[model samples]
Target: MQIRPFELERYFARHEFSAKYLLGSSDPEAMSIADLLAFEPGSEEELKRVWLGYTESLGDPALRRDIAGLYESVAPEEILVFTGAEEPIFAFMHAVLEPGDHLVVHFPGYQSHYSVAQSRGIEVSHWHGNPNRNWAPDLVELPELIRSKTRAILICTPHNPTGYLFDRSSWQQVIEIARERDLYLFCDEVYRGTEHDPADQLPHLADHYEKGISLNCLSKNCGLAGLRTGWIATKDRDIYNRLATFKDYLTICNCAPGEYLAGIAVRNMPQIFEQQRVRLVSNLNLLAEFFARHTDLFSWQRPRAGTVTFPRYLGGSALEFCDWLVAETGIMLIPGTFFDMPGEYLRFGYGRASFADALARLDAYLAG
Candidate 1:
């Protein structure tokens, strides 16, 4: 099945490697394997001995258990590993949705959340987020958008770009909507551990909703994108079995080495989250000051979680401003149009080591 180009990934491909300041990256600062295993004894030896062969199709048992520990209700048996978060999205949309099925997805958000379903000729509706309310979607509008063909609701909390998260009440309302309608829930929770406050961390969708599917990976929160490992957690036996069957045609098993590293990383999640939390809180403060200084040039609602902030570019079109900024300062930022957003907004990611330097450069570039 053919699909529209993933604009966000495409833009990153062109600039991610060469940009001097990676101010557009959403993943947090990554650590060396040595750094990751510094506190865990004997991890290095086990990694060296991790057999270089196809791993269990269902995922390595040890790794699955660590992943299951991330949730309150999910078990090791309910988790299925894949190449990355992207893979489960493709697999789930294909296995569970049909050509005429209707899907309601978060808007001004990630492309993959809707594109895969759209490619299948499904009727997809945008559940628009309110900039007026820190990009929160109005629960009142969800039912109006639903049709008899509606089959699934796709949600991203601590959402991409805007970093909008559903509070306890808001989250429960969403679950109630799905339950009332019998619609499957697909929650892309790759940024689960990136909450600005540890207290704000929500319950895992898979653990709370019987049919909810939680897609997570080592990319964003764990800062282990190189691992190329992601998994799906759900209590639905039928979907679990169907996704397993579908994987035979795609990647039947994960890379053995990546699995070992992912296992080690998940096992030490508390440290990773704390490390990332300090960085994000610091960066968010810097961004707030930057925006305040240039009040006329930008307007933004500070995000509640996640690394990126979609700020409206008041000086010019986001694409043009980003292009000029990169050419003039070697700092990279993303245009909101990439996410089908109809505003002059830039998706600035402030979750890296060099983010302060990038902001300083942007300040100089704007002044000149």
Candidate 2:
């Protein structure tokens, strides 16, 4: 099947290594492998002993159990691990969704959510987020988007770009719609623990909906992007088996080292996320002040959760403005065009160790 270029990933490839300050990275302040191994005693020895051969196609049993512990109702047997969140998304669309199958996906989301299926000629209807209402999708629109061929509804909670979280009622509304229509709910929940407020945490989609596929990874919440490990948790046996078998053609199993580290990361989720939360609040406060001071230049709502926010650039041409800003300040911000969103918007991420310094550069740029 012909594939569309992933603009966001492509843009990252071009600038991620060379940028002076990465202000638009989605992952939180990542740790050195030493820091990751430091969490658990004897981890250094375990890493040395980690087998080099292919691991279980499903995942390491220990790792799967640790991942299962993150959910309320999901079990180790129900989890299917992958190389990354992106790979499982590709597997699910290819293995479950076929051409002519209709998909309802959140708009202004990660491009791969809808684009892969669209590339397959799958009929796609966007569940658009309202900029007028802090970038939330109207649940009232779900019924209208459903059709006989509508096989799934995809969403990203504590979402990317906009960082919009569905309130309790809004969250239930989606589960209800999928249950009523028997549509698969593919929830990209990689940003699950990045909520600005603990009270705002939503139930794990896998635990709540029988057919819901909850996608998660160590990259975002745990700040272990180098692990490249992600997994889907669900109670649906058929879905689990299907994706597990499909894994053969792609990465048969995760890297043994990545799995070892990911298991450690997930098992110690509370500590890792607590650190991230503290840093998130600090950076978000900086972002709040930055935006308030330059209200004339930018329009943004402080993100309720997650590290990134989509802001409308009041200055000319978001792409051009980002280009000039990066060139002058050595700080990189993702242009809105990558996600196929409104022209004036750009994704700004403040979830890194360097965010403070990056914000200072931005402050200098705006002041000058």
Highest lDDT model number? 2
Find the 10 residues in a row with the least total lDDT in model 2: 11-20
Can you list the residue pairs that collide in candidate 2?
A: none
* Each prediction's whole-model lDDT (CA): 0.89, 0.90
Residue lDDT tens for model 1, 1-368: 68999998888887765679988889989888898777589888887898887789999999999989988878999999999998889898888888999999988888988998999999899999887788899999998999999999999988997888899999999999999999999999999899999899899999889989999998899788888899999999999998988888789999998898888889889989899989999999999999999999998888888888888889878898877777767899888878898468778998898899999988887777
Write model 2 residue lDDT over 142-240, tens digit each, in one string: 899999999999999989989999998999989999999999999999999999888899989999999999999988888888889999998888888
Clashing pairs in 1: none
* Angstrom error at residue 88, model 1: 0.3
lDDT of model 2, residue 177:
95
Q: 125, model 1: CA deviation in Å? A: 0.4
